[model samples]
Target: MDELAALTKLERVYRESSLLCFTETWLKQDIPDSVISLTGFTLVRADRSEVESGSSDHNLVNLLPVYTPVVKQQSPQGKEVMIWTEEASEQLRDCFNITDWDVLCSPHGEDVDSLIHCVTDYIHFCVENTVPSRTVWCFPNNKPWVTSELKALLNEKKRAFLSEDKEELRRVQRELKYNIRRCKASYKKKLEQGMEQNNIREVWRGLKHISGHGKSGDVLQVIGDQAWANELNLFFNRFDLARHRAPSSLPSRQAIHPQLSSFTPQLPAQHSALLPTVTVDQSTVDQSTSTPFRLTLDQVRRELKKTKARKATGPDNISSRLLRECADQLCEVVLFMFNLSLSLERVPALWKTSCVVPVPKISHPKELNHYRPIVLTSHLMKAMERIVLSYLRTQLVHL
Candidate 1:
């Protein structure tokens, strides 16, 4: 509405003015009717090509052009002379004001280069030649003093620009801080909640499933669960892309257990005929040994119970957890037998010291071989034990 009102006022002013200047009116020659309806300014077809080529929009004045009157005066003895009227002379003087020209030429910091060059050329032309001063028509709404007023207006403009820049900087900083803090807090909180570690075995299985060669089917068809499907598909796509860029040595699904079959059986009579059986003296072997080695599972379990009781009464320390973990790993390795001999007794202690876990003797339905079972890595066993313990502890604490 404000724009419409302003346009109306401009049209009125332009119609009242005695001088008019236009540009780019040639292309809009047929648009004269629309212009007249909109602005009520008279359009005159002053040139031939403008009408023929419909180029009236350019170099076409809608208003009358202002002109200076040519006057003649007779001097004494029939001598004739011409001089401008007082009004014309005053208009000329106003247009050629040296002070106005100086002001126009003065340095405005914002537009220093091009504006200075233009003003310098203009002032030089006026000073060096007999130049007649005349006022050029501007658009009715165009501010004639825009060039001279630029420096004064720039003070507030610069302040506004700086203020806007500062605000934008503050906005961006706030967004950055929020995103970074949110991401960090989410990562740490998920760690504390044990989300990633709890599902690690499943994650490994999903990774294996994604390697189509291992799973023997497409991920979507193999994993019926929607969440698992999504995760598997995403990981598989990532793996495929990464593999294309740089191939990774992915581990194969071949079982790492040794089979105890494929051997020819020897007959008892042949075995007896081939060699003589010999037995070593146990007394000599025991005498030669320096260490007593009298450790038992009961004694080890007793040590564990004592440590737990002590830690229950006091705050748990890092060393305490380490020892507890060692005890757990010791238990995981040793399989109990009713014979209760030195082999059974030495197993747990040596297992603990050796830092090795025995192969899991699981009899799951998924097992392919009855004699051989999978040997899990020590690291994997330890990590699994830690995760389960921590998860149970967290649940208990919550309860």
Candidate 2:
């Protein structure tokens, strides 16, 4: 008997070995009642650990509450049917001002008669069957029940099926939750990394200095290192320099700056004595008399002055503003590219502390880089100027 007792004790210990270690931590974090509410069946104390274990031992065990599924005798698996009860029918008929007799009549009589038959059949089947199932007949106007013959009709297998379905649904929900958490964590990490990168560059460059390589000989040279110098040299060697246009102004007739004189072409002077003095030929004179009136050049100039004084001042033009904005946009793009390149570490020497100058404060749009906000504004201004000038020219032609 002692030997038999010892063998049984060993077997019992082995069987219990698979059970959860009810450590203090696990005990304290017992499943909440709300979690229990999600299940259809109550969990026993012994099954708690089994239900709680997830895929791993370190992972929390999850238990999905079991429940009996409500077996609905749908017309066809794919087709959806609304089940209506007797009390519900009466309520709906009253609510909608429908005829009571019409509702109770044959399925073919009333518009909603088919709905009533479906409900009646489902309710009758629930009462007559011998299984563990709950039949809920939902009707319009919030009616939910019919006959009270559902005591002996529920079955275990059906309940198990419903429980399994619920478990599967819970599993899917858990997976989705985990995935969402993982994705959120990853996204946050990436965002923080980007912010860190930005901070590094911002601090290293300081506030005023340009972040990347500085410009030299119209070519961007890396701030430091042999590679950058070589690249800069190669780039500048191939880079073509562009000439800027001079601002428009009144032309000077007198001698001025040598550079201006060199660029300007000399105009031909009019020789007053080139034409020979001619006397009106008496033979060529016609005998017919004509009106001999013509206005003097001085009188014509006086008349033009009077017309100019009478003209109205129109709305101000934006040509000057347009040009300034274009310049600003170009500047902005250049600066942005510089800063961006600095972050990329392409030009080490330019981004260094010693060589770079403090960034000058830009008060106007003209200071912006060409590729940034200024470019868009500049293009718009240009288009507007073109349109206004074209319209003005057309109007002038008409005038």
Candidate 3:
């Protein structure tokens, strides 16, 4: 009814005009054309099928191309993510320091897996409770240097437009342009600084940001398509040995050396007597010399401190930044876990598992060969491995 009233007004305003056309009326087949019929024009209707069929000819006369303006669709904003700042780190450290780990993480009969899981869960809980976070609207074409001030200015511009303040809107537009230039200059300077410091990673990251190439482009979206994922899995594991084939048995020493098999002979009595026998008392030997090396608080602390804060977390969801920041509080528990693992001669199952991220080798990847797998393992496990490696190197030097 409102549409009909608008049409009547349009007819009155354009009394001398002959033709008026409307696209995308969204009118249903059941809606009669008489309801929306204009006063002086003949009612004509062209549905989607008619339009498509009429436009199918390639040699049609005066067929001017109609280019509709492309409107970018904004993606839905994601959930609020934690922001790790100095204050948040301090709060997390305090949380770790105040917690009684002995009471909170009482493992069931020295189960290393249970102990690790409990500790990780508690740490994650503390982080969630203590860390500061904010919702960030991530635009597809957003620049790396777009700060909060610029976002505020954009909002102000919108408000000015809504309020019909031309002067205010123009002022905001000028300010936004200036800030955008400043931000670009600042970002360029930072990239130059990174280059001067010989930080290849940061330089590459900045280059990618400038080129508008994001990490999202590298991800293969095979969610809910199990067949494609299975195909990729099979392609990745193409070189693996077939499970049905049993491994060939290794040849015996005698079989490897045919001459030795038939040439076995007993040593002469005189030569056997010449070989002097030397035996030492077992009680005289030092037993302490053969004891296994145990991990110390300092060793664990050193390894934790060495962890790079910017590195991605593993399957456990334990960030390297958390371990590095709270090394002092984490050292004792880690040391205990390390010693327990050594004593039992078994590592935690959680440490063995890793999250594999497939990174594309090309811009447009279509096959398995175009991707390389990057495995993210536990940071604590890496630290423990480093400790063992250092110990082995020290022992090797002494030998």
Candidate 4:
């Protein structure tokens, strides 16, 4: 019985022999490895007898095994949605009305880009300050039919369930069911309205929402990392580099049109007489007839009014809704800027930049070609373009 007990004790020691620690072993260098070593175990030693700071070194070594809790990384947040109110819109218009336009008009030789930047920045500041915004958390598995009210009811139902209250649970469940039905009906109505208006984008969004198969979030997730983003950037810009590459050989003008190289034609008598032989002095020209076509306040206002309220903003972060809402107050400044731009024959640099959004063409996109680039440009620039187009159209009709 004693031998059996000893064998069991040895077996237990061997089973738990992963690590063995010892301290305060008052031995000398003469104590060889054979004396301290055990079978099937390797030994390690730290000799501090010759060191001056033996105690401090021992303390430092003891502190090395301190615990550090693991920190969990958080998921990226969703985009912030601004809540535009009637009062806020009114305030924004009022703010615009109060702003002085003389600063923009005062500088005669000021850069067009600077003037445009100032105007857009001021408008953005006013809108941001006046409008209220909130962040809506979007989860991967979130359903479009789940409204805030429904979520609150769900929480109540969960509490009731935990508390074992049958009546409360039943009441909450009924409310939840009703809300779900109402939300679904409203959502369906919105989808119908989108279809009636022929809004293809909204229609596709609705279909994706119902089917729970949106590729936007998935694409963003895949490209969120820097490695994938760099690869996509290189891939997308490859064509640009190729297009701008210098050619090896150039074609001569004569080679381009071999027949024109030796042919020299003379004008007919009627056309030759029509050509002006004398240069007209600038001072003698009619000032009224030579004046450039200028933009009118009414034209700017009309274009501003035509701006779609819910359209996405450009790189400047200025919304179309603000422009449409404050058309009356903004038309004068826009008129002045447009005329100045016409006189100088220059467009604002800010207007030339656009925000590019990559939209996926397939459900699971692997290649960069599977994405379509959608550009969002400045609404103000577009308004100016429309005014210019109208003027050109009228001029064309007369010709």
Off by over 4 Å in 4: 1-77, 103-109, 162-167, 185-205, 213-289, 360-371, 397-399
Could you arrange the candidates by lDDT from highest to lowest? 3, 4, 1, 2
Tens digits of per-residue lDDT for model 1, 1-399: 443234335565444555444445343435454543224444544332554323332443445334322221212133222233455434333435433533553454334334434543453353234323444333222221233234334444456544667775555555555655665565456444554568664455444433433421121222136674455445435755676786568643333223322242346786787787566666655654554433355544334433431231111112232234334333322212111223333222211221211221343322222123222222222333343365457444432
For candidate 2, give the lDDT of residue 207.
24
Residue-wise C-alpha lDDT for candidate 3, range 60-128, written one tens digit per residue? 111112332222343645677779888988888888888887885564458888888887888889988
The deviation in Å at residue 53 for candidate 1 is 47
Question: Model 2, 268-351: lDDT tens per residue?
Answer: 456556756766544334421232222233332222222322122121111222223223222322233233332443432211
Give RMSD to native, each candidate: 38.7, 33.6, 10.3, 14.0
Q: Pick the candidate with the highest TM-score.
A: 3
Instruction: For model 2, state the Cα shift of residue 209 in Å.
Output: 34
Stretches off by above 4 angstroms in model 3 are 1-80, 105-107, 195-201, 213-224, 227-289, 364-366, 397-399
- Model 3 reaches what TM-score against the true structure? 0.67
> How badly does each model clash, as a count of residue pairs?
6, 26, 0, 0
Per residue, candidate 4 scores C-alpha lDDT tens digits across 269-369 of 88988986766555534643487788888889999999999898898787888888899999998888888888888888888887766677776787889
Weakest ten-residue segment in model 3 by summed lDDT: 56-65
- Output the TM-score of candidate 4: 0.62
